[model samples]
Target: MAEINVTPFVDVMLVLLIIFMVTAPLLASGVPVDLPDSRANPIDQQPDQVTISIDPTGTIFIGNERVETGGLPDALAAIDRGQAGNEPVIVLRGDRTLQYARVMAVMGELNRAGFSSISLVTNSSQSAP
Candidate 1:
């Protein structure tokens, strides 16, 4: 009686496992910042959605593009005008050290620029191990 060899199957599976292992870390999120913890749930399901990040240094970023405080309104307006809808959905990621007033001011600017679908980006406190 002759037995069929399964070495090829084992080799393919091992290769796939190695590939996944190598790419898994790359799939993780960007650099870790001191994200403001919250009890509120995040609404975004798509990873490619628009995001505006405010660093602790008061630097403003629109979809990863660094913009001056004066340019924020125009930057947001550009994003809004380029979108399919007038009211673009934006995720605001502010540092924990960011002042409440500054954050509110950003939100106000977004509202005045015609963005009604703004969502605050926060990681659930309960999610941390």
Candidate 2:
């Protein structure tokens, strides 16, 4: 009778698991932001969150995909239309160099598009309470 060796495979899996566990936190670094300090408390977040990023150049991104301003409303409308049951939280990440008016404009657009549960993304390292 021939038996397959399972011990070595299990050992390799264990080693990989350890490696991943050590680096997992580093991997979750969300879109970088030089967020202005706020006195408000941070909100607890779930896994079902969507991110929209605005770079220093004022370029908009939806999960790494460049989105034109003209198409932003339509894209958000699509998201709202596609919801089956649960509503996903939308998070906005804007560069600190961006003008406040521009950021507010985007937020207003999001609201107009019917995205109610929106959150602003921030760098946890720099954010205070």
Candidate 3:
């Protein structure tokens, strides 16, 4: 009776597991921010949606490009022009350590730019015992 070889299969599985573990975090969108925990339901991600991230220091980013608060509206307008008539969803990713006002300021800009579909991104809250 011949025994089946399991060592190579186990090695391949281990390598794949490690690869996924390393890339999972990298798959998250926009700048790295410590998102606040919330009980809100997750929203469906849109392909044409725009991500604006606010880091701990209150720096704003459109995707990976840093943009000044003053320039945000114009930047958004440019994006609007590129997308033509379709209204792009705006997702705000703010650091948990940031003051509420800072986040609101960014939101204010988005509102002034006439972006009605805005969403705040947050980490899911863990269930209590």
Candidate 4:
């Protein structure tokens, strides 16, 4: 009877697990935005959701895809059609450096498009609440 050693395999697996753990949080940093910090608790997010990002320059994006100039309503309509029966939360991520009116305009567009489930994404406050 021959028995193979499993120690090396376990060590390799452990190293891989540690590597993944370190990088897992970094993976969600999509479409860089300097989000404003808030003291409020974070919302319970679902897996199925649509992300609307507004950068510092006021450029709009739907899940990393850019929306054409002055075509937000049309883009939102397309999203609604594509999702069909699935009603996903529309998460709005506006850069901290962005103008207040710019964020409001995007929210208005979402409202006009009939997306009721909306969330405003913000970074956690550094200081204690």
- The candidate scoring highest on lDDT is 3
Error of 3 at 124 (Å): 0.7
Candidate 4 lDDT by residue in tens digits, 12-57: 9999999999988667656788999898788987788888999888
Candidate 2's displacement at residue 58, Å, is: 0.8
Query: Compared with the true structure, what per-residue lDDT tens digits does model 3 show for residues 1-129?
Result: 999999999999999999999998787665889998898899998888899999999999998889975788788787753455678899899999999999999999899888888999998987742
Q: How do all the candidates rank in terms of TM-score, highest first?
A: 4, 3, 1, 2
Give the runs in model 3 whose Cα sits over 4 Å from its true position. 1-14, 81-85, 127-129
TM-score of 1: 0.69
Model 3 quality (TM-score): 0.78
Error of 3 at 32 (Å): 1.7
| TM-score between candidate 4 and the true structure | 0.85
Q: Rank candidates by lDDT, best first.
A: 3, 4, 2, 1
Q: Give a tens-digit lDDT track for model 1, residues 6-96.
A: 9999999999999999988555534334677777865745544577778888788876578886998888767734536544467788888
Q: Report clash pairs, candidate 2.
A: none
Q: Estimate the Cα RMSD of every predicted model relative to the unseen true structure.
A: 4.5, 4.0, 3.7, 2.4
What 10-residue stretch in candidate 3 is worst by lDDT? 76-85
The CA-based lDDT of model 2 is what?
0.78
* Global lDDT scores for all candidate models: 0.75, 0.78, 0.88, 0.87
